[model samples]
Target: MSSPKILSVDDSRMIHTLINKGFAPYDVQMFFASNGAEGLEAAAKEKPDVILLDVTMPVMDGVECLGKLKADPALKDIPVIMLTAEAGKENVLKIAKMGVRDYIVKPFTEANVIDRVSRLVTLKPKSAAAAPAPAAAAPAAKKARIATDAIKILVVDEHPAIAESIAKAVSKRGWKVVPCAGPAEAQPHIASTVSSEETPDVILVSLAFPGKGALKFYQSVRMNPTLKGIPMVGLSVKTAIFDQNEAKETGYIAIFTKPLELGELPDRIARAMDLDITPIFYSSEGDCQVVSIPQDLSETGSIDLTRQSRKKVADFVNAGFSKLIIDLTGVTKFEIPLIRAVASIIHECNGLDIKWRIVGDDADNLPNLPTVISTNLKVAALKELPNPFTNTAPLDIYPTRAAAAAAF
Candidate 1:
């Protein structure tokens, strides 16, 4: 099929620039018009697939332009999306009755424009058409993470409330959030702090900002040579695939949608920033180095466990710890990654001539144990394992942490 054609009729140069950036990754023919009169001319000449119309214009306002388009049988069929800053009831009602495809409020992200336009067109990725394919290289391994000090995160959002909520949630991990209203406020922040001790390690942006700030914020951030390599994360509504895809194209390391899954954000940041995390999973306890496994051993977490084993392996030897305790007291589920991770860590420790013992009870002490993800075969297989009460050989079974410690 031929490439889709789109036209934007906005007076603001920034909005036009933002729209272009939004569609930069797509295989589409873009047309621009500075005002309503120019939009009518362009729409007539190009017979575009869709038109993004602004409410207030010098020559002719959107209300008048839209009415004329609807009246003309040739152009009436074309989809039109209204771009407006004001959300007044009268204006909304007026435009609502006029049969515009949709309306996007200003201070929106490039993702927002892509999301709206994608509803009307099948967006084809421009990867092949835009750039020549390069030589393939080995996929980079995810670096082990550690948080020595606070990982400063810059949260750029229109709403301070949302940023504050995220701040409260992640503060426990020693991640500090610097909240800003928009790009304007964020500029000064980066200016003063980029080279300082408080430089941002990651940026979290709300794609649904108030006016037309998100796109501008992204542009300003990207324009800087120093910050070009910094990782960005897009925060958008869950249903907005286009926005998410746009973010992915623009090199956002992660796209977290609302309502945020409060559990996962920190992990993404940790991986992106690649902080040192040796202390999080392992600690020296008495004469043993205790490896505390998380309750839910996600695939990523399992991989991280293996990657992080390098540092603690030597630390135990250096500190003269004689025993390695695999503390699975908190683990309630059994997954392949978790099993593999434990086995790998055991091997690592074994290489150094250090002995390791697990500090966990049988099925009774561990509640809701599963062999893997809810498969009947796996569940049945797990059920056959002997409980502590029914075990024939009670070798190495520890009743408590004290018992485990005593055995070592």
Candidate 2:
């Protein structure tokens, strides 16, 4: 899951830096804006969970900015925190009526800002003050946590030391860790456990393992009902967009570089499992081919190929492309559209004349996609190919139109 993003809308670079640093302890992706207009734009693009607005700015004042943000239906749900030197009760009350989450007085302590932000981030909203007692107070009949349902985790790596390090770091967070020194060892463990009631919640795979080995691990882990929805995260010493692309196809949800700012690991892990704030990961896996759809699919190519991209995927039964290679070893959240598009295309291409296979996605992003996908596609590792094409084949999940055309 992407961190709970915060957009700091302040004319003062000092304040923006301060808020960001102070909240650094918490897992969050921070965005900065000098004033209201830029702040609004950032909010739309970043979809920040929280906004810190400065009252006085060169163009739009905080109050007016807050008004505009609340007016936009798309931005309204996001919590806004108005910051200013104004400590008057009247001023606070005024901003409060505008739906601001909380008002912070400038020249404030870092602790104050952190506390207020944390409170807002953790709270739920209500249409009216008198909304019925919260859901927690009225517990449901479902059993809360089954003993066998304890969080299941799989650690995949070629290096025993690294696998042990990750397992040690993550175990502190209360999740059960099952470490596999290589994908070969990981497969049977995952296969046997996946069909059980509670499957592993997370799989941390190292890309250094042989591509074929990694793919097999992901395939086994994802091909079962109990394990299908688990989120997989990749951990490696080297972090690159390419690495992320390679592992993304096999269904990993998030990717992180090793020597990992270890302190943040627990929080990131929690967020991935917590569906409310989870970020979407996009990958050109299966029948989902992430092309700059608006541009690559265009004739004249007037579209901004960089900003608005689309994925072209064949529906499950209709899919025919035979060479399947997915690179998800380095992927994070920006690739969600591609992931959804791939699933859609695969669904459309099912039962088609084409023989499809996949490579990469060693991290297990979409842990359960394989089980659902197996019904329609013949997924495999690039190394598993029987003939002709070899591992050297330049197949990227996020391929250029020319590259995809060449592959076809």
Candidate 3:
């Protein structure tokens, strides 16, 4: 198979040289552009598997260029990863909403760039060639190792041994696996899956494998909605300055190093889901550090507050996260058991070292009856007994649900 082509658009020749040097060991064809317009031109002609886009340029900045590339029918499917100087929350959210695969802040390490790109491309797979038709098989079906609708996990690395190890670790969790040698082969898979309704759930990628090729692929995946929500985790043996920053800037939920631990996956998967199920504990300095639960309680939707959740919440209160933030925003309708369970959590919090605060959007029923009924059991930190904390309270009515959540 031919090496995958990577289009790297940046004003800095140093970055281009660094990227090429980092990717030299991989099977990659490199393309460079000094500005977004030229980058677009190259992308249109080359139809490169992935494009590494720098956000700031002299003519037609990265954002504009990205819009043009995505809008064009012939080039839309190609993935583009944006390279920006500042990976601020606002900027990230803006580009994210605009559909960039991923963003790496400036001064990123070579490994960071490669790691992010590899995962995104592998998850989506794109190419010019048509897929081969499925062949006929025997009537007796084989019980598949992975379910057809299983959460797909993409593993990227040049080393077969490492890839196999990752596959073993992830398989323990009952996830489907797709392994690729580098970004070139990965892009076609990304494209095909992306064109369909079902996409991979998570991507585990190595930054050093395809280097810049990974960057381009990440860009493309971020732009597509089907692939956007999928979780990404980066793997590397050694962490560098840029590598750590890139992990944060590129929007990966977490980064892990090689000699992969099978046990750590449950926590990683939980974070990827953004469950807020992890408990926040106050450090000696009063800062917060997260403590993980054995399983994602949110995934199960309703957890019996019998022992485990009760203990976890109690621990948080003991550790000084007694200032509780319960998000009842999704819950308009509540059952009696759920209400009681919540009340139990609060009761446990109050007895511990911390003060519990019930912070959430306002309920539809003012002086909500369920809440009132459960008040004796409430143990959250707050000022008033009946009224939940509000910024500009004593309102004639209640603030909007969003407003209440923010205040609490």
TM-scores of the candidates are 0.50, 0.32, 0.33
Superposed by TM-score, candidate 2 places the C-alpha of residue 376 at a distance from the truth, in angstroms, of 54
Error of 3 at 268 (Å): 1.4
Q: Candidate 2 — which residues are off by over 4 angstroms? A: 1-149, 192-198, 239-241, 275-408
Report the error of model 1 at residue 193, Å: 6.3
lDDT of 1 at 22: 74
lDDT of 1 by residue, 272-315 (tens): 77765557778777777888777665555566667778556755
lDDT of each residue in 194-299, candidate 3, tens digit only? 5553456677667665455445657766776667766777777765546645755777666677766655554354455443332221112133222211222332
Decide which is better by TM-score, 1 or 3: 1
Every candidate's CA RMSD: 26.6, 21.8, 24.3
Worst 10 residues of 2 by lDDT: 294-303
Q: Rank the candidates by lDDT, best first.
A: 1, 3, 2
What overall lDDT goes with each candidate model? 0.73, 0.57, 0.59
Rank all candidate structures by their TM-score, best first, as comma-separated numbers: 1, 3, 2
Best by TM-score: 1
